[model samples]
Target: MNYLAHLFLAKDTPESLIGNLLGDFAKGSVKFLYTEEIRKGIELHRSVDTYTDSHPIFRASKRLIAQPRRKFSGILVDVFYDHFLARHWSEYSDVALEAFSSHVYKILVDNQAILPTSLLQIIPMMKAYDLLASYQEIGGIDNALRRIATRIRWQNNLADGIEDLIANYQQLEADFCAFFPELIDYAQTYCYQADRPLA
Candidate 1:
């Protein structure tokens, strides 16, 4: 999952949303810095990433990519899944994607002072570009991957690797359709079992 999915999975609180978004930057034991609810959101973010990486269905999706681009398949698939989630947002939730996107952007922007240092730098760009609303288009995925490629340490080929996603688009959508519902269920159950909020 990526930013939108993490936010979608977060409990409806400013702190929880901030914590979930912080997962990308706050590695290791750093989540302990937050309140219990925020910590739960951070923990949920890691759990979702671990679950997505290990699931047989997600692994199957990664295998569909060509061998040459296989090394970056996980990153590609994560973005691809968000595209599907945005495209099919109406089917999954009653809230319109545009409205939800605006809401999340407001939450992040309004609470900027509380955000992790890394996220504070990125959130402005995300809101300015309207990333969540743009995910319905393949071009958005391409642009996002290319931007990611420039930031990474390695000689990542993500700029050209969007083709892998374009080529296997249908199968990847099917895979996301199959996997996301299960993931939502798992996340809900996890939060419930942990005595944390799910919405």
Candidate 2:
């Protein structure tokens, strides 16, 4: 079984392992997101930095540090989401919160083996990007490109999570429990017989 699958099985059979597994997964997921986000942020920062530095409005305003501005903006947005919104907003915005959760769950399930649990942290941000992508007012190919970049960052984070941690353990347990009876039946039918080995 995959490490994550093993982790899931361990959760029920060896509860002591849960803490280590959760910790490992969390660290791994976080590292993955940090690496990917920083890389993308740098690239985007560079591009925007170059463009804005050359723009007449930016030049006139003396805002030549476009890269820092972009980076700061992203960091601020992330801080707001993580500190203020992540835990609290779901109470008021059920639809948006559910959509974000569902999207993260889908990604986690689809890439269970490769993604770390820590990376699931960015699911909300990715959902935000998804929402932006669907906007009709954004207009032009630039919006599409931005959306794609955001998504790629999201996917990269997902892959990193799978690599670092086993996620959706509860869901996996539920799935197994749901089908356990049938599995037991199959095991009994195929692997056991009435005239079995001696006691």
Reference-based TM-score of each model = 0.93, 0.20
| Reference-based lDDT, residue 108, model 2 | 44
How well is each residue in 54-118 modelled by candidate 1, as lDDT tens digits?
Answer: 99999999898788778988888888898999999998889898888888889888987667787
**Model 1, runs deviating above 4 Å:** 195-199
lDDT of 2 at 190: 27
Off by over 4 Å in 2: 1-74, 81-95, 116-199
Prediction RMSDs, each to the true structure = 2.5, 21.5
Clashes of each: 1, 10
List per-prediction Cα lDDT, in the order shown: 0.84, 0.31
Model 2 poorest 10 in a row by lDDT: 1-10
Model 2 has an lDDT value of 0.31
